[model samples]
Target: MLMYCEDPSSFCSLVLNITSATGNFIGNQLDLLYLGWVASLLYPAILVFIILPSLILVLLYISAFLLYIYMRRKKVYNVLNETLHRDPWASGRYLISLLWDAHGYIWHGYEVRGLENLPDEGPCLIIYYHGAIPIDIYYLVARTILTKGRLIHCVGDRFLEKVPGWKVILEAFHITPGTITSCVQTLSENNILSISPGGVREAQFSDHNYQLMWGNRTGFAKVAIESKSPVVPLFTENLREAFRTVSWPQRLWIALYEKLRFPIAPIYGGFPVKLRAHLGEPIYHREGETVEELAQRIRASLNSLIQRKQKLPGNILRALLARFYEPTKNE
Candidate 1:
């Protein structure tokens, strides 16, 4: 023990021990600082990407549930015997109306021009370009309920039946399985029905080109002819900007969807963009018009509407900024 004072080498050894301890302490402090820095980056990312979206989704579900309960308790969803066909599931209809109204107002500020073109009464066929998610359809339906007190029965993808727990909601919304017969019947009964001739293919692969994928698909035209309902060509401005499929490897997804009848494209974006649906004057089927001819005429009419209303290669930023500004006279 006396070597501490007597032996120089022993004193050097003690100093070395102190230096080693100091180095380890500093290294540990640096490691902690590094960990803190990493955590600082990770936490916000978790909050934004994971927590916030999940919370928002949960909030929506909760809100829907509460609204449903309130409607049920108030007997607001019941169908009166006389108006059963006109306003089925009054409570559900009302709840959905509120939800879509809030969504259209807050998220997109959606509006329908030429709504006057939609008859106040009688059968009509509304054929619109299908967006990646077709959210605009809901807005149109809700707007119809609010403006005309009429329900716009929709022809939905057949795969909608495969979605678990969606059947009831689909029925409530009068979303019929996509079939020529059902469409014809809906229109024959003097109901307003909407369908997309392009359906999932156009929604998946059309990109921002505003092209119709209704190749040789004249069933809707036949429905219009058989039901004797005037076809209303509808197109929404900035519809492509609201949602889009992933661009990379899109052809592969389209191929898969074609074979399996499944929407395989990864859809993204629900930007708070401006969405306006323009309805052209209703086109009636001429006596000599073939189904193919009728379909082509409607397709061309819709394309012209698109060319007039939407810019090619739609810009998401421009659409988003449109929420704050009014449309121009030319637009």
Candidate 2:
């Protein structure tokens, strides 16, 4: 090898070139290895964050639709036909029961306290804080049907009527208009009625502070007074964390809702967060109480329930962790 070199400097240059090539080759391989490691992590992250949640929601709705078809085929009771024989299993209560067992218990592990406050019989008014999706309220409704064999009438927002194909379902659930007349009639008929005074506005705009957006809506209180129904205050812990609406541009959404009464905000989060529903002591309307006075009392009771049970500025991670461990009330 030494005899073959015509120029010593040239030979030295060749040796240095070979060394540099070897070093570069090793560095390239190391970079490839690091990139592969990152790919492995990113794939699972995509699955967890994007794919799995969508799949879960799709499966939930599909199963519910299938169950509804099965129930309909059985002809236990016709949803539109008032003359049909009353069958509990054929009713909306049965559907809610199935949903409770499948989603509430297994996935969210939802629980309710002060269920005893719900009267065994008679007309009662339940006013609950509406969450972003109000899925917890669905769980509560399901639980009530499962335990009490009684249906809780709901006064839905006027917008629900505008949704195509929801008419039959709404009728089956006994969801009447949020009018004072409809609410009073529901209570006078000795039905346990549930109403959310904040309605769509609260669901769309309320933040972690859990502020009640009731704001001078005394219709529910007036209905209670007219029907002589005991008003029960209800709040669910960590409701804001489980499903949240887009916070930015909240003012625009609020204004649109106030004027047009449309729900236009984007909502996210379907985490398996622990949910607990608490019902405060039922407040009866006093003989001399005006509508404003009754409404204020109800609002205060609901706020008290939220303060006593929920941790302020709810954290999504903590809400998810609550699935594994118990949640403590904020001091």
List lDDT for all candidates, in order: 0.84, 0.83
lDDT of candidate 2 at residue 283, scale 0 to 100? 98
Best by TM-score: 1
Q: For residues 214-318, could you state the per-residue lDDT of candidate 2 as single tens digits?
A: 877888999999999999999998899889999888788878777897898999988888888898999999989999999999999999988888888888888
For candidate 2, report its TM-score. Answer: 0.75
Which ranges of candidate 2 are over 4 A from the true structure? 1-84, 87-92
Q: TM-score of model 1 relative to the true fold?
A: 0.78
- Top lDDT hit: 1
RMSDs, each prediction?
A: 7.3, 8.2
